[model samples]
Target chain A: MIRLGRKHLFEDLPRFFASLGGIVFAVQLVVVQLGIFFGFVHSSSLLIQESRADFWAAAKEMQYLEITLPVPYSWIAKARAVTGVAEVQPIIIRSIVFENSNGALDYGRVVGFDPAGSLVHLDDHPVGDLREIAKPGAFAADAGQLSSLGVSGIGAEGTIRTKKAHLVALVHDTQPIISPTFLYTSLRNAVLWSPAMIDEFVRDPFTSSFDINSPLNFVLVKAKPGVDLVALRGALERALPNSRVLTKAEMIDVTQRFWVKRTNVGFILGLCAALGILVGMVVVAQILYTSVNEHIREYGTLKALGIPDRLLYASIIWQAVVMGLIGFIPGLLLGLAVAGYAQNARGIAIEITLPITLEVLGLSIAMCVVAAVFAVRRAMTIDPMIVFKA
Target chain B: MNEPRAVIGDSIVMTYPSAAGPVHVLRGANIHADRGEIVLVDGPSGSGKTTLLSILGGILTPASGRVTIEGTDVTRMPRRERACLRLARLGFVFQGFNLLRALTARENIELPLQALGIRRAERLKMIDALLERLGLADKGARRPAQLSGGEQQRVAIARALAGGPVVVLADEPTASLDRENGAEVMKLLCELARERETSVLIASHDQRIAPFADRIVSLVDGRC
Candidate 1:
């Protein structure tokens, strides 16, 4: 039965190729889309992920990892005084505009950290250093952004919110979410550059609202050993009425939900993947229908010869499965290779693990089975008595 | 001596339902063929010649009357049982040569054996013998497209009888062939029936087919 089924499947090489083509296209679309979706989800929370803080304290509505308002910088001292708080670090994350080489306006997230604090992304110094960044109007920039920042080298200058910011040193792999142009500077200079927050005391010009010592954007907290981070979080939340300290998992969840579940990215990618599968299914079903129509007479002959419906059914299903497997191998490999390129150049992570490979393989087989059902229905209902007619 | 009847269609009445109305194709048609006998149902087009054969082969059920093959009544049986009877005991040759185009002559002949779950070695042996008997010994590997009309008919004949069925039904088997090929196919079927003691029931309007039949029953308006 298998032998006969295979011969019949290959009877029309074009139909066979068409079936395989549809499945391959579907698999590639699903794999690449899933990869890009995951990549976007990963980069969304990269800042919080890279930070060494066990708990992060932020303003009440700082649900998003990228944008946040400031809590008073003095909160760092108060948080350190808490029983289980090992250390507290002050940092400011704000959106600042920049001027490129051609004076074209570009904007990005500018981060300000306490110069003595330890939280930079460099190799030798696991924590970080702000010695060069502490210098007046100087900040460290990721070397990869030299061209984006319109700087020739160290000591080159760029305008951060119209303030003179000299690039003192370059760092590696500092791609922050929300904006690609990231600039790192000392807390004092960051406050100097950060626009002063406005208070409702706006009606009084004598009591100006432009205060450099107003607040800090983020307070990074490290918990002491033998202390439950969850309890410390509760304590910090209680100590600060309108603020929250989020854990790593909580932050990741918040970011993932923001992009995948709560946003349109997940819906759009899901629809594309489904469309790919749907296209493959429709192609296979249409092709199988043609194949069945072409061989309707043969099927009638088989029926008249006492061939059972089960054998006829088995033959069609086997053809579909064979085509699916054949298409899957090449499509999966090709899609993975393309995804690998996106991962490196576009930062889209298509981590095709072993389990994922097996899963997609299963999906391909199931896709063919479902496609075969369409042909099977037609085959089962074929009038075997057609052979009796002239 | 009373010879065993291989197929008996007694007062068969069948009507087909259509959008316009019920089509009265067969009305009280009676037919029978003895074992080792070659019977021909001669009729004009639309004379229920094909419909009567379909009843005997269990392809269609009659509205009235019964069809029995080798003592098994197929009229009251379910569709699946009737189909099983057709598979295990009946073979057919159609006008179109209906040889699975994807399969070679040998493979086509081996189809019934495959359906019956015959062992591969036995199936091959039966296919080889049938091919040799049909005078297609050297052309067993050729598909129907590659075979001449005469050769294709012979392959179709071999496929019909390969399962050693109790009866072989052929409908306008020679209609697609030249006169010479038609005569040869009829004569071959007659000879094989005599040798195997298998009953053969054929429907045809071609005069060339009559000479090869042991008996010819004329069907007019579904009456024999």
Candidate 2:
């Protein structure tokens, strides 16, 4: 038979495009909002996601990576003693303020780990020797934050916690979300710079005397090849009861959840995405409802000809699907453009991956399908005999 | 010999609820048409001509009456079955032509045939013949707006007959046309109905259609 729904949708060009515009607007809004939300989640958990460690042992009740209480440095040997444990390395995380030569100060995190023993993966964007971070006062900073930190390049000097700090390498893609700028260095420098470590021990920057007894943030653990991580995690957890032993995946999940569930920014972005879907739904529903009323008389004629109500409903739904598929193309394209601008200019990473693209498309189609209900109900109730009236 | 009764509506009564009260449109209307017969229902405005036709076509339920089409009682049939019966056995032509503006002439003629699950090859063959018979051969691709009023009516007639229904009901089929076009439509409709051995019912106040009817039944004061 004739494609009644498609024909009806296109019969009035202005109205048809108006409906499409509504769908496009909805798809665009959803794509951008959710895209940014995912970006935020990833950035907040970047270090954990990039870790090569099989498990992460942190202080008990550690909800966030940076805000955790210090894990006992004694956990290193305890974790190494567990079955299936290949190695353990202590890592320190402390928030510190740094000053440029002009006295402008900004905040940054000190991420210090034992380079020889740590299981953490080397960052792909760093442009210098990783081993050099073991040198006294040596650090790496993201190039993106150099101007804000009042540093020029690899050889620039800055002060952290009243101690002279030298930038030994330049890194990229370290744009921070919840945490501030990152300063990557050796564990000795981080320990000397930490206020807690310095207050507990006599200030001795030259001696560089820190041992396994020092309080640290986390311990990265590596499992023997082919070892069951679940079993290893249980052993480690039991061995270090004061620390939480989590698999790599579990640690990433916990960090992402902490940022998304506990922060106002995440909640606001989520609400904005929901509102976009709602707006799109209303737009499609109103457009379809109006289109149905405009063609009410034709529907009556079809009904009089004994066309099944189900077929009529199918026609209306077909129109909605067509609108969704057609509108999503432009919406996605626009969203990608906006995402790029946000990442480059605003420093807000919006990663619109293939999976995210498919998800948004599915949402777009579902929104249209739900919106078709009103139009279908109206079409079904039309009186067929009205065609008989003069 | 008496021809078989293709359609019958007896003592059909219809009422509509109004703010004032329940306004009765038809009371005890009775009508019948045999196979291959042309029946004209004549009446002034509000004389229940449309109401009687509505009842006979199973579009409206009568307060009290029985209707049978080719020996099948449709009055008590469920709405879905009544719709199926209409699709299989009845056709309607309206004053406004009632053609979907989005479809071409040929597609409109294919509506009922498609509804009946006819194959595409057979539908094309049938539509080609119908278009030729109705003098719409060259205009099959033109939408309703592109066709003139008379051509649109011819397409409507072709649509009604495409499924080879047993009964064809025309309600003011020519009311939108001029006198010349109206007469031509009536002549073609009556000829086609007779040639197919189908019953034709025309409900209208137009006097020009009287001469072509095999029988005329006057509906007045809610009775026929």
Task: Identify the leading candidate in terms of TM-score.
Answer: 2
Q: lDDT by residue for model 2 over A1-390, one digit each (tens)? A: 239887887888898888888888888888888888888888877777777798888877688787776765567778888889888888888888988777889888989987665576557657877678889888887766786687778888878888888888877666555568888888998987764644433222224454434557788898899998878888988887767888888888898888877888777887887888888888889988898898898889888998777888888898888889998999999899999887777677887889989999999999999999999899889999778765
What's the CA error at residue B83 for candidate 2, in Å? 1.7
Task: Please give, as one word, the docking class of candidate 1.
Answer: medium
In candidate 1, list every pair of residues with a backbone clash: A306-B87
- Lowest-lDDT window of 10 residues in candidate 2 chain B? B1-10
Q: How many Å off is the CA of A266 in candidate 1?
A: 2.2
Candidate 2, residue B119: the lDDT equals 96
Q: Fnat per model, in the order given?
A: 0.82, 0.76
How would you encode candidate 1's per-residue C-alpha lDDT over B1-224 as one tens digit per residue? 66557999999998999999998888899999888889999999989999899989998889999888887898999888887899888888888888888889998888888888899999999889888877889999998899998899899899888888889999999999999888888888888877998999999998888888989999998688
Worst 10 residues of 2 chain A by lDDT: A198-207
Q: What is the C-alpha lDDT of each candidate?
A: 0.79, 0.85
Residue-wise C-alpha lDDT for candidate 2, range B102-155, written one tens digit per residue: 899999989888889999999999999989998989999999999999999999
For model 1, state the Cα shift of residue A100 in Å. Answer: 2.8
